[model samples]
Target: MKKLILVLVLVMGVFFSGNAQKVPTSEEIAKKNIEEMDKRLKLTPTQRSVIYNYAFDMAKEQLLLYKKQVAGTAKEEDETRIYRLQNEMNKNIKLVLKPDQIDEFNKLNEERLSGIDPGKKKKKKKKGEEEEKVVGIEGLKSTGNN
Candidate 1:
């Protein structure tokens, strides 16, 4: 029947659309970031592993705090949580990096933040607009031009 066919199409569309919009886990994001940093900083495998573990733990903690902040938490509470997270992150960096590397990391973070276009707000794109894959070291190598 026509009604049955219509319902089937609608259900299929919904299923496929949901599958297309999958968000990466915090661990995935942290690993991707660490991998990129390894490439950029020329970090050794041991350094990369340590940094990745630290970042992953930090991201997990921060993500929970962020969720709380989004759900009607006070600004002061959010700020305190973020400050604590920063301290923890700093401590982790100290454990894994030399003082000079820590300084370099701070500067790199500042530069990256500054380079973002302030006027352009990020918005969810329409389904058809292909998502830009986050480029890691392999991606750069594949492109053959940095």
Candidate 2:
């Protein structure tokens, strides 16, 4: 969910930019995340709790990392750590959610991450478990050998 992180960053950026009278607390952030996820995923009570815990933990880490960055003390490792937190959360979420739910989640998730700059070329990034798409243009697969 790059879109998830991008939305988070944009929201936080806006809040920190003087629009918000006071910074939101960790619990507030977690509650917002849970509400948004609940609306999108239609999570059951159990799924909601599990996701709430996971999202809360990630939010905490993100908040701490953000504070460090604002203080001009965060390292590159901190950035990587946030990425890991997001990836880890997604993995755990998949373990709890049904396959259909995962698909729906992914589809809705993409809607938020769309609209990249028109001038830039697209780059594909795959995680460990994701497979690369194969297009047959009279390639070996076209011969039908499993």
Candidate 3:
């Protein structure tokens, strides 16, 4: 019993410690996002600076909106905010990036907005038969008698 208790405590400590690590700050998030874009786009120094500021501002705004639970409470407003941010970022990007870079950036944004990763391929299902669709909670209710 003593050995079991000791092992359980140690296991719990490791689990909690992993979850207790500090969250990255907005600056950290912005730096990482900018670094990724710079790598893919080969950004000029001027473009890098502009994108860094835009990324930093966006990270801070997203953090604030998340903290406010705006997504849960106001779905339309949250979406509108995100769309505006995207537009502003794109406007800034167009001014600094080359024409070819703009096309690449647009493609990257399209992939992100669509939630599709180009590197991973999902297998296609058979086309011969359609799957059954459940209607409402009726399908989930317990049918067994007490």
Please give the RMSD to the true structure for each candidate, in Å: 16.2, 12.9, 15.0
* Better by TM-score, candidate 3 or 2: 2
Which order, best to worst by TM-score?
2, 3, 1
Where is model 3 poorest over a 10-residue stretch in terms of lDDT? 1-10
Question: In candidate 2, what residue range of length 10 has the lowest lDDT sum?
Answer: 137-146
State the lDDT of candidate 2 residue by residue for 2-120, as single tens digits. Answer: 55675666657656766546777778888986887788789999999998899789878878876786789989888777777888888899899998899976765565455232234
Predict model 2's lDDT versus the native. 0.72
Model 1 pairs whose backbones collide: none
- Go through the candidates in order and give each one's C-alpha lDDT: 0.57, 0.72, 0.63
Model with the higher lDDT, candidate 1 or 2: 2
TM-score of each: 0.53, 0.70, 0.60
Model 3 has an lDDT value of 0.63
What does candidate 3's lDDT look like per residue over 37-102, in tens digits? 887789999889999999888777655654455235645576467557756777887888999998
TM-score of 3: 0.60
Angstrom error of the Cα, residue 48, model 3: value is 0.5
Clashing pairs in 2: none
Residue-level lDDT of model 1, residues 66-119, one tens digit each, is 445446663665556555665676567667876667776766555444333223
